[model samples]
Target: MPQESSHADPAPRLHRVVVIVDANSNPFELSCAIEIFGLSRPELGRELYDFALCAAEPHTVMRDGFFTLTGVAGIDAADTADTLIVPNRPDTHVPRRPDLLDAVRRAHARGARLVGFCSGAYTLAEAGVLEGRRATTHWQWADGFRARFPGVRLEPDVLFVDDGDILTAAGSAAALDLGLYIVRRDHGAEVANSVSRRLVFAAHRDGGQRQFVERPVPEVPDESLAPLLAWAQERLGEPLTVADLAARAAVSPATLHRRFRAELGTTPLAWLTGERVTLARRLIERGEERLEVVARSSGLGTTANLRARLRRDTGLSPSAYRRRFGTAVG
Candidate 1:
C-alpha cells in the first residue's frame, strides 16, 4: 500500500491515479473521473492526487471518432497508480478488449484499488475481478449484465457498491457519487464536502437508484419541503422536534413523515439529527470552541452526547475530527 501524505509537511506526496479508456469509452464517464480525481484542488492546502489518462493503445480516437485523445500513456501506467479507474464501455453487448482486461486484472493483482463506473462494470466483469463479488451497473444494462456474467451478484438498485478493494457505480450521474465516495474514503468528509460544494452536488445523497428509476418526472422545489428545510436549518441550535417541524410546515405529523420519506428518504427526526451532526462538524472543524460549547451550540446538549453522536455520525470523537479536519490543527 502507498504511504499516506503527512499533514504536518509543507508539501505532500500525491497519490497516483490512472484512468483507462478506449475508443468506445463513454466521454461523459471519462470526464467524470477527470473532474473528480484528475483535477487539482489547491484549496485542500496540499496536493492530493497525481492523475493520468492511459489507454491500451496510444493516440486513440474516443466515442464518435470526432474527438481524439493524444499523449495518453499505455496500459503500463496502471501498474504504478494507487488507484485505477475504468470508465463506461460504449456498448455492453460487445466484447471488451483483451489487452485492457489484462491490464485491469494485473493492476488488481498488484493490489491497486480498482473502480468501474457505469457500464465500466462490464470491463471488470470481462476481466473476472467482479466474479463472486457484489456489484452494480447502469440500470438499463442490469438484466443483460446478469445474463452475461452469471457468476457476479448484481444489486441493480444502489448508486454504487464498495467492496473494499473493488468498487462499482451505477449509471452516469452515479459515477460522481462513487468518485466523491473514494475521495471521502481517502481523505475525509471535510475534503469531500469541499469538492462537492465546488461541483454544486450533494456531498451525500440519500436513498438508492430506485428513486431515480421509479420516478422519471423531475421534482419541483415548491412540491418539496424546501422552505421548511431552510427554516429548520437556521434553528438547528434549538431542540426541534418532528411535531415542531410538522406545525411549521402546516401539516399533520403523519403527513410530514410521508413527505420526508418521499423527499429525503429519511424520517423527520433522523433528518433533524443529521442536520445537528452536520452543524456540530462545522463547529468542530473551526477549532475555536471547547467540546461542551460545540455540543451546546450545535444542539447536541452536552459533551457526552456530542461524543456519542460524533462517533455514530463520523466514527470519530470531537477532538479526533478536529485533528483530522480542523483548520487550526493543520
Candidate 2:
C-alpha cells in the first residue's frame, strides 16, 4: 500500500499490498493482482511488493468448485498494508462477514489506498469506503450496486473509475487496466509498460468495458486476415491504398475492404488510422520524443494530424497527452 508518487525516483520505494479474496472470488481478478503486484518485480529494477493472499475465514472455497486455502493472514494484515486490493468476491451469494467489512473500513479510515475489481466494489461499499466516491463494477451488476448503495456515485461506462484514495474497476478484463494504472501511478509509465510486456497484455484499451464487451468476434474461417493485418502494421508509415492492400492480401480491392470490415469491424483506412494513433499514444506515453517527432515516427506524418485524431479519440490533444503521460517532461 505505498502511496502513488507524483515523481517517482530512479529507484522507487517498495510497497506492501494484500489481496482480500473470498470463496466467490474470480480467478482472473486474482491473477491480475498476482501479475501486477504479487509477483517479484526485480526485472523492473524494483524490490518485491510484500504481497499476501488473505481470505475472510480460516478455510474458504473458491469459485473454481474446489474447497481450498487457509493462507488467511488475519484481518490485522489490512491494518499495516500500504495498499489493499479486493478482487471479485464470491458472487452475490453469501453475505460478507462482519470481520471482513471491519477490516476494510479500518484500512481505508487510516488513509490506505483501497481498490476493488469487478464485484469487489460491493465489499468496499459494504465497508462504507465508497460513500462519496465515483465507482463502477461489472456492467451486469450496475442495477444491483445502485440498489444496494445509493450514496455512492456510479459511473457504469468507464473501464475503471479513480476517485482519489478509492478506486474501482469494471469486470475482469478491466482489472488488468486498473492494475496497470496502479503501476503507472506508483512507478511511472515505464514500469507500467514493463509490467504489460511481462504479462503479455495491452497496456491500455481505447474505450471502456463496453468496447471490450461488445467487440465483435471475427469469423476466422477461410477468410483469416491475420497475415494482411500483420503486413499493414509493419508498413504503417507507408501510404497504403486499397489496391496496395488488395495486392498484398491476394484478393481484389473490394474483397479486401469487405474482409477488413468483417474481421476488424472497421474499413482499411479507419483501422490504419486507429493503429497510427495507438502507436503515437504509446510513444508519447513512453516519454521518448517531441510531438512532431512522435507523429512522424508513429506514421501520423504531422503533429497537427496527430493532435486532431488524438483529441477526437481521447478528448486529449497531443500536448496534453504528452504532459500527462510523458515521464521525461513531467
Candidate 3:
C-alpha cells in the first residue's frame, strides 16, 4: 500500500479543537473527530490536535429518548478551541438554544473554523453562521431545512461542503469524509490518507453527494448466512445459482428466499449480487487486474455485467473503482 509522507523534523504544537456535543449528538460523528484529531499520530511523525468534547451545560447529557448522557464536559470547554465542531442535531424543526448559538457565533468571530454534520447544520443555520452560505445536510431533511432557513443555500446530495471558514457534511458516516477532508485541507492528502488507513477505511470518498444519494444499501446478515455464505465466499470463481445455495443451506428455493429476506433484509438474488460486488471491490482494491479476470473470479461473468453492477451499486465503473481504490491499496 502507498504510505503517507513522513515529516522528519520536530512536530509542531498541536492545535486546539473542540467538538460540541448535545442531547442529540451522534456518537459516530464524535468518533470521527476522535479518530482524526484526538488520537496521537506519532507513527506519522505529525503533530496531533488537542481535541475535547464540549457541551452547553456543566454536566452534559445526550438523548437516546428515555436514556440520558452524563459525565460530559460543559460548553465552557469549547471557549478556547481553535476549531469548533457541532455534530448532527436531533431535530431540524426546533431552533438552536440561544446560548449555544451565541457560543458558536463567538467561536467563529474569534477565528475558529465551524463544522456541522448532518442535521447539525441546523445549529449553524440557527446561529446565523450559515447565512448566505452553501451548505448541506441529510437529503431527507433538505426540504424542511430550505423552508426553515431561506437564506442558506442547501445542496442536498454531497458528502460535505467546505467554504474555508465553515464546513457542513451530510448524513451519518459522511462525517468521516468531512473530518478527513478537514485534515487534508489543513495538513495534506498524505496525512489524511494515513488517518484513513489507520481507521481501516477508504482513503477518501468523492466529496460529491451524488455518491451517497443513489448507492444501494447492502443488507446482509453476518449470522444467518454463515455456512452458505462461507461456502459461497470460498468459491467466488465458480458460478453459483439459487439452487446451489438452497442445497447448501438444506432448504427449498422458497425457503432460501424467505431466509435471505428475514435474515438479510434483502432478496436472495440481491444478496448474491452484493456478494459478487464485494468480491470485485476486494480484488480491485488489492491491485490492478484485467477487468475480465476480476469479473470471472468474482462470478460477475463478464466485463459488461461487472460494469453494470459496479455502476448500479457505487455509481462508478469498474475502471473508476479501480483507479480510486487500487491506487490507495497500492
Candidate 4:
C-alpha cells in the first residue's frame, strides 16, 4: 500500500521534480536523479529545480538489505510534480508495484513530464505509458523487454529516446546524458554545460549505447588518436580540413577517417563544426562580445555565417543567446 505524505504543495509549477523509488531500486540511478536535480547549483544564480524523493511504500528497505530508507514522501508527491523520474529497478523480472504504476499513470494524466532511466523504462511500460511509443532500455534486457512489452517501440541501440512528454534512457551513464539533455532543453546549453563542468562529465557524448554493447571494453591503440584530437581542439579557430587532420596525425586521409568513425562515431568535419559551435557558445555566454569578433574567434569566419551556424546548432541567434545566458561569468 502507498503511504500519504503531508508535504504536497498547494500550488505546483514547472521545475518541481519528483523521483520515484521502489523496493530493490538501483542506488546509482537514484543517485543520478539526486545529483542532477536535487543538488543546489547556486552558480545558475537561481533555484533551478525543486526536487524530492518519493517512495511507493513507507519505510522501504533498499535492494541492499542493510540499508533501510525512511522519511521519504509517498506517491502523492509525484501527483503534482512537473517532472516525474522513475529510477532503474534492480531487475526486470521483479514484479511491478501497482501503486507506483498507478501513480505514474496519474502523474502523466495530469501532464507531468515522465522520465525513466535504464531499466526504469520497464515501469513505464508496465504502466502502459510507453505503449505505442518509442522507448529504449538497457541492451542486455532488450530481448526480455521486447518479449514482455510487445507494444513498445524499443530502440535498444540508442543512449536515450526523447518521445516528447515521455523520455527513456538506456543504461547507467546514459542516464546522465538524458538528464543533461533535459536541462539543456528546459534551461539552455550554458546551464547544462555549467552543470556538466561541475560534475566533471562531458557536456555531450557522441554516438549511442550500441557502440558499447558489443565491445564493452573499447580498445584504443598504443598510438591513440588522443593527441591528434587534442591538436584539433586547440586549432578549432582555424579552417581544418581532413587533409590537415591527416597530416597532423601522420596518417592518410582514409585511415584518419576510419579512426574518427571508429573512435568518435562521427566524421572529422562534423566533430570540428560541433567544437566550433561549443566555442562560440562559451564566448556568447561569457561576456558582451561583438558578433563579428565571436564569429572570427570561433572560426565561423563571418557574422552571417555565425548567425546561420548558431541558429543551426542552438536555434538561437548570437545576440539572443547572449541575452539569455551571458549574465554569469566564470
Candidate 5:
C-alpha cells in the first residue's frame, strides 16, 4: 500500500533481512527469500539488504533430513534485524523452540517487520503476534490454523497476506510472490520489475489471488491471460478499458472477466488500474514534475484523479511521492 529509483544510488543504507532458520525447515521458501532479499544485484550497482540466516541450534537438520545446515548466525541475530522472516517448517504439529518464539515476540515488541512463508504463519500465531491480525498459510493447513488461532483472521484463499508489517505466504511458490510484493513496496514498480526480470517471474501478483487455481493447466492453453497482460502493459499510457482488452483477446467482456478471475483472481479493470498506478509512481520516481503529464501518460485522465489514486494506493500525494523518491537531474 505504501511502498525504486533510476540510476546508481550513492550507497544508501540498505535494509536488513534476517531469517530465523528452524529445525526441519523447508528450504524452498528460504531459497525464495534469499533470491529476493539476500542476493546482491550487481546489475543495479547497489545492495538491497544486509541478509543473514540465524538458527536456534548450532546444527539444524533440514526438511526430511535432506541435509544438515550449519555456520549461520544464532537466534539473537533476529533481534538486530529490521525485518525478520520467521521459520517455516513443514511439520506444523510440532511446536517450535520456546526461545525462538520469545525472539519473535521481542521482535514484534520492537516494531520490526515480521514475515511468514507457508507454514511459518503458525509460528507467528503461536507467538501471539498474529492475534486479531490478518495472515495466510498453505491452504492444506488453513482449517487447523483457524481452529488453533480463531482470533487471527486467516485469509485461506489468497496467495499471501500483507497486513502492514506482518506478512504471510500461502505456499512455497507464493513465497516468491510475497517477496516480490515487498520489493514493489520498498523500491517502487520499476525496480521491482527489474528484479522480476532477473528472476524470470511475473512482476506483480496481488495478494488476493487464490493460492492455487482450480485448474493448474488449462484445457485450452491459449485461453491464458499472459498475452493480454503483455499487450496491456506496453500501452499503459493509452486509455485502455476492459472492453478494449476483451476485444484484443477475442473474447466477450463477460468471458474476459471470468478468465481474469480464474487466471489472476482479479477483475480486468482492477488489474489495469493497478498497473497504471505503478506506472505513475515510476514516473514520479524518475523525476516527472508535472502531475498532469504523469496523469495523462499513465492514462489516469486528470491531475485530480492522479492525486487521489496515488494517495489511495501509497498514502502519499503526488508531490510528496516525488519528494520521497524522485531522482531529479539537476
Candidate 6:
C-alpha cells in the first residue's frame, strides 16, 4: 500500500454568505450582491466569503422575465449561511413564497445576520423578523410598507439601517452603500477601501440623500464641497468648528449650513462630529491603546466622549472594539 501523506492544517473557515433569489427579483440588486460578496478577489490576496445563491425553486424567472437564474443551490442553503441576503422582489403587491419566508425566519432565529436590499425589506418583514427592527427600503414604497407592516420601524430617508443582526438598504445604489458598509464592518476600513477602489465606489459614503442641491443656476456651479471636506479631513486632530469650516470655504456660516443639509442631508456640526467619530474608530482598530490619545487625535477631545461615540456607533467600547478588529494588540 502507498504511504499516505499527513494532512495539512485545516484551513480557516470563511464567512458564508447566501443570497436568496426569488421570482420577480431585480437583477441589479442581485448583481450588487454578486459583485460585493460572490466574486473571487485574487487581488486582495485572500477569499473574503463563501458566497452562494439559493432559491425555493431551481429555475426562477427574474424581474419581468428579463432572464432566468438557474444553477443555484436550493433554499436549504440558508440554513448554513453565516449571513443571509433576503430576496429583492420588486412586486410588493405579490406575496413571497412560504418556503423562502421560513428560510429567512430560520436564519434570523439562528442569529445569522439578515440583509434586505430595496424591496427586500418586504421579504424580511413578511418573514416576521423585522417587526420592531430598524430598517430602510425603497423610498417610493415607504407609504405602502408602513401601511402593511406597522410593527417594523421604517427609516425611508436614510441609505441603509444597521440594526445589529438585521440590516436593510433603500433601493438601487443604496445596495452598494450598504454592501460596502458590511465589508467595513466584517473586515476593516483598509480592506473595505480596497474593495471599493476595485468597484470604483466610495468606501465610507457620508450621506444618502440629494435632498437639495445648492449651486448657481443657469451658470457654472458655485463650488463643490469636496475641497472643504478634504481640508477638514487633514485637520481632524485640531479643534475645528463649523464656523471655521464655513470660513475656510469662504462662505457665510448660514450658507454653509444650507449647503451641508442640501448636499449631505446632515447639519454641519453633525457631519464634523461624525467624521471625528470615524477617525476615532480607525485609530482604535489600528491598536491605539490610550483612549485619551485616540480621542484627542480624532478631535473628539476626551476619553469619555470617545467612549460614548464608540458605543453609539459600534455598540462596543474602545477596548472591546480593538480586541475584535485590531491587527495587533497594543
lDDT of 6 at 224: 68
RMSD per candidate (Å) reads 5.1, 6.8, 9.3, 7.3, 5.6, 3.9
lDDT of 5 by residue, 1-330 (tens): 532456576676678999999999999999999999998888876677899999989999999999999999999999999899998988999998999999999999999999999999999999999998999999999999899899999999999998999999999889999999888777766778778889999888778888877446646646678888999999999989999999999999999998888778888998998889988988888887988999999999899999999998778888877876675221
Give me the runs in candidate 4 sitting further than 4 Å from their true place.
1-14, 64-66, 207-222, 287-295, 301-330
Task: Quote the RMSD, in angstroms, for model 2.
Answer: 6.8
Strongest candidate by TM-score = 5
Which 10 consecutive residues of model 2 have the lowest summed lDDT? 206-215
- TM, every model: 0.82, 0.69, 0.61, 0.82, 0.92, 0.89
Q: Is candidate 4 or candidate 5 better by lDDT?
A: 5
Between candidates 1 and 2, which one is better according to lDDT? Answer: 1
Ranking by TM-score: 5, 6, 4, 1, 2, 3
Judge candidate 4 at residue 162 and give its lDDT.
84
Leading candidate by lDDT = 5
Lowest lDDT block of 10, candidate 1: 207-216
Tens-place lDDT digits, model 1, residues 1-330: 999977665555678999998777888888888899888787776656899999887777777786888888888888888899975776677787788888899989989999999888898999999999989888789889999999999988778888778998988888898898787667666677888887888776532434243223566545668889889989988888999999998999999988887776668988887778777887777674588888888888888989998897567877778777786212
The alpha-carbon lDDT assigned to residue 230 of candidate 1 equals 89
lDDT for each residue of candidate 3 in 1-330, tens digit (9 for 90 to 100): 999779688665677898887766677777787887899887766455888887776544554654455666787777888989975666667666777888899998898999998898998988888999999999889889999999998988777888778999988788888888777555544466678889887555545534243224458644466688778879877888888899988889999987765554456676677678767766776673889988999899999999998886566787776665564421
Candidate 2 residue lDDT tens string, 102-215: 889888878889999989999899888888789988878898889989999999877888787888888888889888878766654556667888889866443233413333
Any runs in candidate 5 off by more than 4 Å, and if so which? Answer: 1-12, 219-221, 328-330
Candidate 1's C-alpha runs over 4 A off are 1-10, 206-221, 264-270, 288-296, 299-323, 327-330
Question: On a 0 to 1 TM-score scale, where does candidate 3 land against the true structure?
Answer: 0.61
Clashing pairs in 4: none
Q: List, residue by residue over 225-282, the lDDT tens digit for candidate 4.
A: 7789889889878888889999999989898877777766667777777778778887
Local distance difference test, per candidate?
Answer: 0.81, 0.76, 0.76, 0.82, 0.89, 0.86
